[model samples]
Target: MSQHLPRWVLPGAVITVLLLSWSLAVHFGHAPLMPSPWQVVVALGQLAADGRLVRFTVASLFRVSWGLLMAVVIAIPFGLWLGWSHRAERALGPALQLLRPISSLAWTPLAILWFGVGDLSAVFIIFMACFGPLVVTALNGVRKVPSVHLQAGRNFGLSTAQLLRRVVVPSVVPQLLTGLRQTLGVAWMVVVMAEMMAVNSGLGFLILDARNAGNRYDLVVAGMVLIGLVGLGLDGLLRRVERLPGLSWGFPTARPSAAPAVARLRLLRNP
Candidate 1:
């Protein structure tokens, strides 16, 4: 039997084919609106040579980092408290539910009014985008912690503080990490949108600037590609951090080794 192709290989092939097709289309069309891949590369190089790319990128990175960090600091504590205490959850549930559905963009006007048009307003947008998702995912992760573990902690005469620190917190870490992954994406997205409106520097501002300066389509496309690539890299880094041996200890353990035939069968047809 032929071995199955690796999953990564398929995605790589698809991307290569799509980019080739796009480049050929642009070359044939010879339109400024649709610059060829080579043109985009050249544009990127020119921008980098002028130092504009690095400066804008640093500005965007700082906004995202600060906003995401603030979100985590607030969300994790609130989520854990709600998950641990019924009273807190009951009190906060209605307000959280109300605020969670509001789009991050909707907060832009108020954010501008409160923080003015600058880094503070941009960061506020990112914070709002990251906050709701982080809180919800954290609550889910913590609430889903196995009851048996808590029971065992109680059996050992552990106080509430000890039980939380020793058992509950560690058990819920994977879920928290997963939440962070999602929040990080939202934070990145919000940063770009916020910058387009509130800030005079960053990738979002650069994209708008390129558009206003007349058909700089290559720059707009390059900025979008940069955002997507950076987001993917950040999530991959988080996944690697979570897979560290000690970090995985509280995570579910896999069953011991099975026959190769059984493993293949299970993969093909769940039992």
Candidate 2:
């Protein structure tokens, strides 16, 4: 007769409570900088009605997707080679390590000059963000494949190419997926930052534009919520893909139960 809520229920309830608190704060705090949740909702609806929101959202998504595609094409093969061969690793590792510490923001000025203040610049920044993480993840994943697995592949008469295809690739899949999730999230973030600096037609630009138009706090708040929602949606999609049967193994095991089952088992054994 007892009701046991699903695992997600408590988190959902917590979020609802937080939103309510935020709404109340805006109403009672009488702060102009902090608009009520209803105000944000109203602004969001207006943006949707006006159609600029869709255009900017799509533009941002487009920039990230293009950059991510480019990164995948270049990073995967280069990473695989570096991971599989010591010569390639020696040649590339120091350079990659050197660049890893330099953020996408640091490259923005050069990207702006090289590509100009346009979509290309924004996409280039996203590319830089995606490339390094993807390469590092891919290379680390591949390099970590167990030698015993490779030996088993040789035992099964796999040639070098076959071994790579059938063994190495499969073994690193979980890591690849993990890296991919991180890469895409970073790609999205870079897209927003790049748009703010270089381009005039994305969500980030919209936020800047709203801020410039003076006291369009509603619009600014709306834009912030939209970005959060879009990022959440993208991550949710990735998580769903990761839960597919082939991909499920990539995730770590659920936390272990701590009940005293062993004590009960011992009593049964004695009886």
Candidate 3:
């Protein structure tokens, strides 16, 4: 029997073909302003040699960590309450749903006003981007907790706090991690937008500055490549966490993720 080709093969071939085509097109089209893949690589080397690459990447990461941390501290508890109590959900659902439709970019103006033109403003923007998905993830996960597990805990004479610790938290961990993975990606993307106007040093600012200063498209492309690679690295790390023992037990019945609803919100905001 013949085996199928590996998943990486197709994608690698497509990328190789695209690069060849791009180089040919640029050479023929006489688009001197456009940077070929090799030119982009050279530009990336220049940035790395100057230490700008590490410095800018770290600055962006610092903002994302702070913002995501703030969101987790607040959203998880609120989401738990909303899931465990029908009344709480009914009460706060409308307000949160109203806010969910607003894109993080929409809040950039207010974020700048509230936090000023600094790292704090960028961090705040990332927080706004992360909060809603995490809440939804927690709420959905809590709702999916097996009633038998809850009953078994209660029958063992576990108190509310004990039951929450032993039962609810473990049950929710898998979904929460997945949500975090998605949220982290959103936070990374949001940081670029957050950096564009209110910050002097970040990959986003690097791209913008490159464009304005002598129209250095090579640097712009290099910055974009770095953003995508870093995002992929983050996702790979999260995937490792997902594969840890016991996390998969919760996936037999995964929660309906908030991503689709969030996509709809983006549509509404953009339209």
Task: Please give the CA lDDT of all the candidate structures.
Answer: 0.81, 0.80, 0.86
Residue 192 of candidate 1: its Cα lDDT? 85
Better candidate number, 1 or 3, judged by lDDT = 3
What ordering of candidates by lDDT runs from best to worst?
3, 1, 2
Q: Which stretches of model 2 miss by more than 4 angstroms? A: 1-3, 249-271
The digit string of per-residue lDDT tens for model 1 on 87-194 reads: 999998999999999999899999999999999999889988988888887787778766655665565566888777766777788878877887888888888888
Candidate 1 weakest lDDT stretch, 10 residues:
256-265
**Candidate 1 wrongly placed segments (more than 4 Å):** 1-11, 28-32, 251-271
Please, what is the TM-score per model? 0.87, 0.87, 0.87
- Pairs of residues at least 3 apart in sequence or in different chains that clash in candidate 3: none
lDDT of 2 by residue, 1-271 (tens): 1158787888899989999999888878868687788888899999999997899899999998999999999998789888999898998799999998899888989998898899888888888888888888888878776665565556556688877876677667788777888898888888877888999988898888888998788898898888888998988898888788876552122342223223322333345
Model 3: how far residue 184 lies from native, Å: 0.9
Model 3 misplacement above 4 A:
1-11, 251-271
- Alpha carbon lDDT at 132, candidate 3: 97
Candidate 3 on 81-125: residue-level lDDT in tens? 899889999999999999999998898889889888999899988
